[model samples]
Target: MSFREMTITLDDVLAFLHLPMGGRFYTPGYATRAEAAQTCALLLGGSASDYALKFDHVKTIGLRFGFLQELYTKALRDRRYGPATQMWLVHVVGSMLFACKSGGWYTTVHWISIVEHLDQVLEYAWGAIALPTLYDALGHASQRKTKQMCYYTSLLLAWVFEHFPPTIIQRMEVPDYTEDQPRACRRRESRTGHPELMERQVIFDEMTAEDVIWTPYEEHRDRSSAAVSVDGAYADYEPYLIPEGVPATIEGEVVGNYLDWYTTVSHSVYHPG
Candidate 1:
């Protein structure tokens, strides 16, 4: 919070933009620290809940109790909309309700402007978090990966804000939901017997572990430090494979045998090409 620390953080962010690789905190698309802080402030303002909750509260409860269910099902089925886009839409729709709950902003202008601003911020924030890594894995990934990330990250942001007014979620009394199984309840759609469920949710400490599961990382994940294989051949050497460079490849019959085995058993055939 100090001036010097703030300056240092800004410098760090600028430095991060300089890096060519993905997954660094300093990446380009993110809101600046100041912008992020402003968003947090506006979102957390006293009036935010009032403005956002009005529409959401009734719809959420209806969806929870099996009243109008087909809502989320169609949303889910839509190939064009991902989670993040859907969440921003929900926020925009529920703005007035949230404003009523928040009861902080004096003027309507503040509410409307903030909603538009937050929508833009949310869009950028979701991309900023995941794109670089996606690009790094392969020179480029399909739109599917982008959608996957957007959907999950938007859900993440929604869960974060749902608890903004503490009272709204507490009074709603719905079961906890996570990305895997997002709806704790449903609303039956009038035309189709389908039920619309809540896509984004907040979990409390009282919620059991069975209610949620955290996502696994996209890259190599070592669950434990326990040794998998020992290098007996290199035990005598302090540093093996020093000054990394290409090593000679096995040739002739060995190469032919390896190639045959690779072609026969490789999973790449079924993988994305």
Candidate 2:
């Protein structure tokens, strides 16, 4: 099918859910084919959904479910359509626990399945974007590289469903740059490593530029490694947790400041190697 046809179908799905065809953060409102494509891409890829979920004002989880349901419908027609959708759904659900006035209560009672569904959604996302688009999304050195967080998040989301052993995850540590090896150098190691480098794995948390392309989605060492029972296991798999009692409203600012601090401190403390 042509790009126009595909986009039309995507828009129909978004409309079914009544989701606005619009920009996020920098851009707003669907204005052109390119803008619409971007909005669709963000929703399918999950950037749009994430921004909505971030706001405490987005009280109802149904809005999210409607979005996911639409994505699932799209996935059925073209698995790539849904699968390549953003991998941020988990974050979206998790944000609800914080975003909602009721805290985890509403999530536990109503939206649990959405949390559980992340594995399947993640598999599709990995299958879709884990290639050239993801690569192309990376800007050259002159331009700042796209934030590695989303790429790494996608990898981790896919891995969660893969039933990877806790040992593997624990061992799958991202290199800590502050110590002997900086994160950047470890990223270099991932890039330079010889034949069949994707097999040479690193911890999900240790992800860096060189390691962005490879994910555990395709190959699993052991099927039994999958964590079937959610319970606490899911918590272990998540990279970040909003500390209880930390106002979610302050989170954005705190996170921005923290990132700024981390960058400023990392640079000042250690000369780049």
Candidate 3:
């Protein structure tokens, strides 16, 4: 441990962590360059077993990763670490976590926090790694998407809402649970603030692959019903109709298949009548 670089080996630490200095030496969330570099070195050198064991030490904030019984049992008893050099188990774990986040698997803020708490990063692994791994395995489905993404969203939200540190929950402006809800007789009811506010999760049964359709919907999804057919034909959409507040009786309309008088006059069955 005595033999170290006199100056900050920023690239050495970054390369060891399998991290690319995206614009800055570290992400903007970190406090200082020294803090970030030291944190990266710690992560690159720390043992996974030690990391997992010391997770309980990070008492400042709660974690969001999911818990797997088998994984825990194995890691807890894992004395045979793979890498046997300066960059050890920490690099293996850190690289996996960083890849998952970079590949749009989980949130970025969590990794930044994890980097800051490398000595005791395992505790946050439940929130940061475990849960995200499960999520990525399942597919980054949006809440509004088919049942899968929706289910993921609910579990993720419910876990964060309920299991997250009371202080952490207070930081976010969640409709049900938040500390910043104005004190002027308008404070909202959060599960943590109000003990009775339990999240009633509805679990769905498993189905075959054919029956299951994964569709996660984003809030700002393009919901335009305007569609065209494969054969260059418009499917059920006629965009050339002129409105007259009533039945559009544009006789001899110069569009597709409108040869007869009645064919040209199409009425809007569903609209602002």
Candidate 4:
């Protein structure tokens, strides 16, 4: 219930392990998209359908997991914390992999679920596990808003997650700027029409000034759709993943001091729509 009351440690983060399957379970940790796809394709021979699925169902969430894990590794590699501190911090970040949603492309539930889990440990860590705070810790600075990347807005981490792995480009078909329709429609179309649109949806996500409000959490507006699965088949719905404890360490200095610092600084927890 209270920050001081919850003492978290490393086993907390490493325990996380589920996510919306990207259909590429075979992809190795260090493999490039092309390489991973090849392996995943070979491993994906188990199905009996030709869904013609193109884009990774879990790309955005996958990237988020990847980015956060990279930070986790970096913290360890940098020796930023003592052995015990490093262990738990790395586990805390590793455990975040479970927050992503999949088996159904992008969903508000997925986004909202991830956001909620990201915060589960915040109360224990004085909110250090908060995504925005992690991005800040990662030193992802603001940039000028270009047609490609967000400079000052909250889309920084998103940009990184969506575009960081250059390998993703090789997997895309081509850019399709379907001007006549909104980005959402294009994404729907991309599932078939010009799959390229869906492939790169995360990178060049269409955002208006109004989308800024979506940060931190997205509104759940599709309760009716819950009755049906992505394939229009009936299915048993699973509950959201549980959250675990997370601890914050800063070179063995004043832990509460860092909490005070993080609480004062403002940052967006999620990317703008």
Candidate 5:
């Protein structure tokens, strides 16, 4: 069997999700239970004890999505619009953008710290963090005995539906495209049913270069003529661009050893050419 390299580029994230590709890099730091509880109380105006209880696990000093939702609802009832909105954004970032592997409902308090100052929230390089988090989830899911996966799965699914043939996906009717909406909003997964595991394996085994849609966004590209600019504060993510040939690697013994190990286990399933 031949092999083909399939990658989801930074461009795909920018175009498909319209998430900011440039901003201050978000690096999560360690926070103790006291610190996390303080953050929740100061920003979200809740009892420190109640917030402390949410940190059931020491490793994941985070709150549940259900807890956040309850806070949001309570805030709305009390007419505390500002805190309510902040709670909502916190829930979105934690549950959707930077979800933890613990489950879909649990999210770390790190996002609460980030969302504390709403005015500066846009200054975060969300796309940078999100892509890598998804990659991490995919890596974990690929391991033996890993039954479930988390993180922003919608991005991965959208990438697959856009690049793969409909025969393999059995996609539903797509919605009309609009410049205001992200590309991901238009596509939906099959609602009828899915093929069995063996059937899917056969479909993948038979996949060829002709079966893949190399450039599904050609029309959208033409329509989006206006160029978007990146701020100078953010790292120029030019390295994410597809290279001409075998990509350059960082010169280091560790990297070299990893590359050797990866090459032995990794096998391509399709050849584009």
Candidate 6:
């Protein structure tokens, strides 16, 4: 059986998830424990020592989602509205969008700095960060002994469900989808009785171009019209589109070589055949 190259693109991310793809790139630099504690105290109104105790470990200055939730609750109870909202944002961004593989709970302290000034939270390129993160996680998960992965996996799942035939997916009906809802919201994957690994591989091996849904969302385009509007709010992501045989370049250097690289790379799964 011949193989076909497939990928999740910025267009898929925008159409399915409706994440913000504009503003300054998200570059959360590393933070030492002292710096993390200081930021936590200033933003969440806690003592430095108390904040220090929330770190995930001695070497990594990271905080758990549980700790962030506690701080969020405390800020709300104390009527510190600003801190509460910041804490909530941190928790959501960390746990939902940029989660790490550390037991699926810890997030680096560097994210706290992003929310340091509330006015600038919306300025970061969250979708840009999320897509790369998902790509990284996928690469890692493809490696041997890699037992787990974290990040916005919903994007990958949604892209697959949208592009592939429904025979491979167990989707539930979404009755009340609206213009404001993300395309992902219209389909739900059933939880029970999924196919085993080899069964899934057989199904994939049997797939042909005719089985693919090139434009599965065409019927829903009218409902999703508002969700896909860029309208000066998002960054110009169109220039990065990866059309067939076209190279993506930066400073006149081709970066789309990854397409070739991925085709040749060995992608062994964690389990033995």
RMSD of each: 22.8, 21.9, 22.1, 20.8, 5.7, 5.2
TM agreement with the true structure for every prediction: 0.16, 0.20, 0.19, 0.20, 0.77, 0.77
Residue pairs whose backbone atoms clash in candidate 3: 55-123, 64-127, 65-126, 65-127, 66-131, 145-215, 145-216, 145-217, 146-215, 176-190
lDDT of 1 by residue, 50-144 (tens): 43443244332111111112333444566424443433443433331221212222111222233334435433322233333333322322344
What number of clashing residue pairs does each candidate have, in the order they appear? 38, 15, 10, 8, 2, 0
Worst 10 residues of 6 by lDDT: 263-272
Residue clash pairs of candidate 4: 10-88, 13-91, 13-92, 13-95, 14-91, 20-101, 20-102, 143-151
Across residues 128-180, which tens digit of lDDT does each residue of candidate 6 receive? 67788788779888777888876777778888788876667677768897646
lDDT score of model 3? 0.30
Q: Per-residue lDDT for 134 in model 6?
A: 84
lDDT of 3 at 26: 26
TM-score, predicted candidate 3 vs. hidden true structure = 0.19
By lDDT, the better pick of 1 and 4 is 4
Residue 163, candidate 3: alpha-carbon lDDT? 27
Candidate order by lDDT, decreasing, is 5, 6, 2, 3, 4, 1
**Number of the candidate with higher TM-score, 1 or 3:** 3
Give lDDT for model 6: 0.71
Model 4 scores a C-alpha lDDT of: 0.30
* Candidate 2 regions with alpha-carbon error over 4 angstroms: 1-128, 140-142, 145-273
Better of 1 and 6 by lDDT: 6
Clash pairs detected, candidate 6: none
Candidate achieving the largest lDDT: 5
Error of 4 at 142 (Å): 12
Angstrom error at residue 109, model 3: 12
